[model samples]
Structure formats: structure tokens, C-alpha cells
Target: MKEKHEIGALILRVVLGLIFIGHGTQKFQGGIENIAGWFDSIGLPGFLAYIVASLEVVGGIALILGLATRVVGGLFVLLLLGAIIKVQLAVGFIGGYAYDLALLTISLFLLMNGSKLYSLDKLLFKAKNN
Candidate 1:
């Protein structure tokens, strides 16, 4: 049971990390400009869109390596919260809330649990246990 839990957590971590990275990559590639323009169209400050994009990209990379997992996860949680508020809240549950919910849940989990075995944090912290 313990092993299964660990495996499940690790899987969630990896998948979530990958998704974050992809989001970040899209922003890094200038997709955020388009997104920002959209935000502007919708009465939001275009700059905020870029800020969210940058945070997503940076936080995503950190999550992927399990480096500063708690911090990154927390940041992601904030980002997702903003996303939910700015976009999903009015769009209804089926529109964009689902993905944000998933990401937010996983990020909160990571913030609470941190990384697992085979993570940079594990490697760095392991010596203190022995």
C-alpha cells in the first residue's frame, strides 16, 4: 500500500510537472502575447497575462526537477487560483475549471507532500537521515 501511494504520488507529480512545463514553453515561445492580447480584449491588463505566463514557466521547470517543490507548487496554486478567478469562474464548470482544478489540486498536494524518491530534494536531504 505504501509503495502504491508513493507510485501514485510520483506519477501525479511527473504528469503535473510535464503539463506545467508545456504551459511554460508556450509562454516562453511568445504564446503569452496572444494570451495577453486576449486578456486585454477582455478588460484585463495585458501585463498580467505575461506575468502569469512567466510564473507558470518558471514554476513548471522547478516542479519538473522536484527542486523547491513546495515553493513552486505554492506558486502554481496561486497561478491557478488567478486563472480560476479571471477566466473559469464565469465560463462555468465545464469550460476551463476542470483543468485548473486538477492542476490546483495536484499543486496543493505537492506543496503539502513535497517531492518523492529520486527527486533533487530527496538526493540533497537523504544524507541527513543516514
Candidate 2:
């Protein structure tokens, strides 16, 4: 049973990480200045574009590696929530929010549970039965 849960976590982490990496790479390909321009058009600080892009890229890697899962997940949840409030909500659930909502839920789950079996966190910080 525990192994099953661990496997589930691994699946979720990998899928979510891949999605983030794709999106992050897209942002980079589109150019940070262009992203910042879009952010400005949307009434957010232009500098946030770089910050968000960096978070997605680096956090995605951390998630895939199962390093600091809780921290990365929490950050991703916040990022997705911001996207929901600032953009996706206006598009409505069917149009945009469905995907964001799903990602947000998964991120929340990871944030609460952290990584399980095949995680660097586990290997690096294993408890000793002293």
C-alpha cells in the first residue's frame, strides 16, 4: 500500500515537472522581454516575468529530481494561483482554468506530502534510529 502511494507520487511529480519544463522553455523561447511586455500589458510588474520563468525552469528541475519537493511544490502552487487570479479565471474553467486547477491541486498535494520513496530528500536526510 505504501509502495503504491509512493509510485503515485513519483508519477505525479514527473508529469507535473515535465509540464512545467515545457512551459518554462516556451517562455524562454518567446524571449524574456516579450514575456515582460505581456506581463506589463496584463498589469503585472515586468520584472516578474523573469522571476516566474526562472522559478518554472529551476523548480521544474527540482521537482523532477525530487529535491525539496515540498518547497518547490508550494512555490508552484503559488505561481499557479497567481496565474488563475490574473489570467485564467477570466477565460473561465472550460477555456483555461481546468488545466491550471489540475496543476494547482497536484502541487498542493506534493506540498503537503513532500516526496516519498525515490526522492533525493529521503536519501540526503534519512533518519537514523539512534
Candidate 3:
């Protein structure tokens, strides 16, 4: 049923959002500068650490609320892809890219489906149509 699918999406969105929030919080707790330094060591611009951290936190909230879900999901897909390719590729799948791959798939699903019900996007869309 359509409602079942909507519920499924909601569950996925909330869980994924929580995961991202935890990761972003961890980055902050561990020191963004340290993350930046690590990024630099990995051949990424150190400044990107701030951007990535911000996105993870802010985007996680957006996802939980289902605000601009597609956009946030799109960004997450790119972010995960970059992590998999740039950082985890050499480490192999079992403990390396596996998590990232899972996250990427969830993001891709959200990107494609957006949000249907019990979401800010749905509320706003309905309001606009009324």
C-alpha cells in the first residue's frame, strides 16, 4: 500500500538522519580542525571539513524534518560517494566502504523518492495546492 511505502521512507529517513547527526556530532567532539588536518593529509582541502561537518548536521535535521529531502539526499549521495572513493576504497568493503555504501543507497532512495507524508515538504506542498 502507499501508506506502507510512506512509512518505510519515514523510517529510513529518520534513521539515516540520526546516523548523520551522530557522525557530525562526533566530528565536532573530536575537533573539526583535527578532521580538517586528516582531510588535508588525505589530499582533500582542509577547509572542506567545516563544510562537510556543517552539511552533515544541518542536512541531518533537514532530513528528519523532511524539508528539502531530495536536495539533502542528493548532497548526501555525493558526500558518501566522495568518502567511499577517496577514503575507503583501499580499505576494502567488509569494514571500509560497506557502511558508506549502505548510507549511499539510502541517500539515493531518498533522492529519488523525496518525501510523501508526515513531512514538511508534504505539508507545504498541500498548503500551496489548497
Please write out the lDDT profile of model 2 over residues 33-111, one tens digit for every residue.
9999999999999999989998998898888889899999999999999999999999999988999999999999999
lDDT of 1 by residue, 12-119 (tens): 777888897788787758677798789899888999877877777777766667678888888889888988997798888886699799889999998898766567
**Candidate closest to the true structure, highest TM-score:** 3
Could you tell me the lDDT of residue 129 within candidate 2?
A: 11
Candidates' lDDT values, in order?
0.80, 0.90, 0.93
The pairs that clash in candidate 1 are: none
Model 3 regions more than 4 Å off: 127-130
Give lDDT tens digits, candidate 3, residues 1-130.
9888889999999989999999998899999999999999999999999999999999999999989999999999999999999989899999899999999999999999977667888787887746
Residue 99 accuracy (lDDT) in model 3: 94
Ranking by lDDT: 3, 2, 1
Name the lDDT value of residue 37 in candidate 2.
97
TM per candidate comes to 0.84, 0.95, 0.96
